[model samples]
Target: MTALAVGCPYPPCTVPTRDLQPIRHSELRMDTHHRGRVLTLRRIAPVVKLTARSWTVTQESSSGGTERLEVILHRSNHGQDILESESMFMVKEPYYTLSDQGDPTLRIDHPSDLVVCTGSLGNDISCPSSGEPGGAVAATAFAAPVTNTAKECKDEGNAALKQRALPRALAKYTNGLQLVAKDTAANGSIACDLHRNRAYVNLLLNRLDEAKADGTASLTGIKDQEHQDLDAKAYFRTGHAAYNLGDFQEAKSLFEEQQRLAPSDRDAIAYLRKTEVRLHEQATGEYDFRKIRAGLSKTAPRADAASFDRNTEVKKSPGRGHGLFATRDMDVGEIVLCEKAFCVVWGHEDEALTVMTYDVRDDMIRGFPAGLCKAIVQKVLNNPSQIEKVMDLYGDYQGIGKHLIMRDSGPVIDTFKVHDIVARNAFGPGPVYSGGPRAEEDVRNASTGLWIRASYLNHSCVSNSKKEYVGDLMVLRAARPIGAGEEITHSYNESGDYDARTAALKTTWGFACTCALCLAEKADGTALRTKRRALELEADAWAEVEHAAKAKRISIVKARCLARSINDTYEDVRYNGLPRTALLRIRKWLTEATTRDLAGC
Candidate 1:
């Protein structure tokens, strides 16, 4: 085989003759016109610089005579000096042959093809029977030949999957699977890829069970690393399905398995832990689903719990619809509803109710409930395996014991959940209230509670109904007449300023302030700013009078006049009803003034 180099104006200036090898017979036969083209040429001797437009090739003919070949050329767009001739010569022999017959007019057109030629003259050259590159031939050889009609279907399916058409991807995968059920090598990869994609689609549609099954199938026949990943995904999807179905134990187990397979998967770990906590709560009877149902059912009559029929009614907002409404006019002190919380999450503080000491029939005092109490105490002390799972889910119960101590010292509790709802509307400790004659009253009211149904009472800066706790029951008594269709609201904060209240509602509850009182408060704020200046002047004047009286310089008449002026300003500015702390300070100052004698001073 022989090889030669041809120069072109493009980069990598010299191209090899016959691509430095022989062209395949099949490839050559397919394009016969391109065969034997002088695709490349090399210099036989060092030559002087020649202009691109005019060049000469010197060759020794068979007769031993030196022949000079001149070719007229023109510059091409690609900067190549092209020959304008009907014939050209071989680089070595200089024998003229057909070169310009189909020579490309544009230099850039298929310049690569023009640069390299393949023929038997080049070393390591061979004619390919198949008209493809070696690697493509190898891949084709590895693939099994289609023996059945199903093979064509499978191929079509694969094409669809590659196109990212999910329905078609699934159809192809199923058809492919049906064609070769036991063949792991030929159809397995295609089937698995299709199933994986289907699982992704199912997940997007929130079909957890279908997603889990598809994920499982996708993992089949996969290698070690890929198999483990597929298994983790399968288990994770299974966990989610179980969680939505309220099978917390099953969900926890599946999630734990997923976490074991992929320890760095934070979402799996977090969700697994949450499921474990829920399971533990269920086992301990800490979460009462029945109570939640009862609460929601009882509140069904109130407008707060009304159900909207989506088929007939056009909803103005996503979750807005009339369901619960008053059936009849009810007076003050009437029973609106009686309901228990869906779930009561007793924070760690409720441990005080564990009954540590027992009053025995004998004179000696022993642990309460001897058996049950001991078990409860032991569970707390030893930290049960179930509790470990809960801890794994929510972290170790840090503030639980502290709450227990506070509960013993008369702390409060709060709880929430709704009935008829697939999931709890809320979940947390119930609120409690403590008050007594003694400054340090160490008696807790465990039975005094607020239920989840009470949560339906919307928030208000000034509420018409007052919430009163009477031993595990919350009574909502009307402080004023409630009109029909008006949302029942309660005060979330007893001591919050207008700004603080607005911020809390917006941040925590995701709502804008549209309440009547809120509007009035906004308007009052502007007026208050002006009144504040006058009130400050009056206060300053009273302070001066007080100082002069203490120094025995001002008369009692003048001091009284200043004090009266301050009081008048207080009433006008609404500071007369200031909080207890400010009121006490003013009273102390007034008492001192009355005690001192300023006769003629």
Candidate 2:
């Protein structure tokens, strides 16, 4: 028999604890003492077991863009239904060793208690069995500890609230929440206050899930009764958000509780009635939510997606080596592909490091929980080509990360490859940015992840596709229609002019722009260059158009003609649209010129 102190390396893995001890399986353990509680274990021969099942995949074009896919997994062959259908899972009755209605020894309490992983291509199925201690972590877990005082953060939030600066208020509340979680500056009341305030702000900002989470936190873990009134606010606002989000049952429960705590609140009464009406409507199927859904779809393009459309494939592209290409006509908002991340790092670290070392970046991958690290390592090792694919990204790993990255450390080569892949392709610690070259600011705030399928997208100033990150999953959606055999591309940056666009792309990704627009701009002769310079001037400098006239020493008349032409048809740039900005500037300049009686006008 052997006992060893070990970090848990199994399911229920989102928890970190220092007290866990791993024991040999052959040595069945007896009960242990913990604050005067007795713990027991039962045999597994009569207990439940899971078997590998069939996997299925479905594909469709995403409303938000990109080819989309949905995968369904099925499990069968248990003799009878284990648990009630209303619970989190439908286990066969024959497999039940416990019951939800009686003893919940091996059962889920309710359907609402269902836990699912929100990140891409992974399951939250890791749970380590250790008689040690444990604590929870969120999807956005980071290595940094909060340093600000809860009171200081709350006071700042109060100031922001006074100014109606909703975003600022949210930031302050979050800072306080982080401080509380890190145990650096918060007491129970401050924690409650932080959660309650953050819930209200989240409601105002229409972040329904975060509002619900904060509201739940505010109500729970309140050891003090002095702040029940604040808790009531959290309940009411959470209910309000639930109602708006169409969770009628949850809204009903939340509103009722709030009304009990604040008996004379009319808003709670109204909400209660509204929730009842909605519940009835839902039971009778009398509500057609399609219209609300349609309206949301119009505005929800900011963050949405899908993938797995076979109309696209990865293949060698001219000058670009490899790229994703469409094999058939695809409509806008169609999802083209879905990919799971290979390795992900939560935040950045600064140390005694050099630019070429990339050690901090490597730590991002190597720092994952032990079980997760093994799973990720095994995944790449299982497919050696995946490592090669990652290595083929942009810059040479040796040229940049050789000093430390390639050291004889275990999995060093694998970590270096993943880091290179993420450095070239990672997106989002925030919502999608249509702009180019993200992740340069404060690496501590950046989240780096690798998506093999998404890496196939090549650069285009006028890309036909865009990507969205749902956790570690990468979904590429079509920005516009595409014909068969067309290569899929996404802008490395938001739309910019020839010089700015090329410079940004070159500096960020080490690529030269040879697109049609670039070639056309290269043909600019002296007169055309003068027109372009005037066209590029800021709105306040509309008078600069006369500089074209000053060149070649011509009259204001010729200058006006050149200005009108330049303004009307600088046809080959990113911001071109109806009612061009240049034309608007020209109109302003023309009005001023006419008032001055310039012959050019």
lDDT per model, in order? 0.38, 0.47
- Point out where model 2 deviates above 4 Å: 1-309, 338-420, 427-444, 468-475, 525-601
Q: Which 10 consecutive residues of model 1 have the lowest summed lDDT?
A: 413-422
Regions more than 4 Å wrong, model 1: 1-324, 347-452, 483-486, 526-601
Cα misplacement distance, residue 572 of candidate 2 (Å): 9.0
Model 2 Cα shift for residue 265 (angstroms):
40
Name the lDDT of candidate 1: 0.38
**Candidate with the greatest lDDT versus the true structure:** 2
In TM-score terms, which candidate is top? 2
lDDT of 1 by residue, 286-315 (tens): 333344334432113111111111111111
Which tens-of-lDDT digit does each residue in 430-450 have in candidate 2?
Answer: 332332233443432344455
Alpha carbon deviation, residue 333, candidate 2 (Å): 3.1
How many pairs of residues collide in model 1? 32
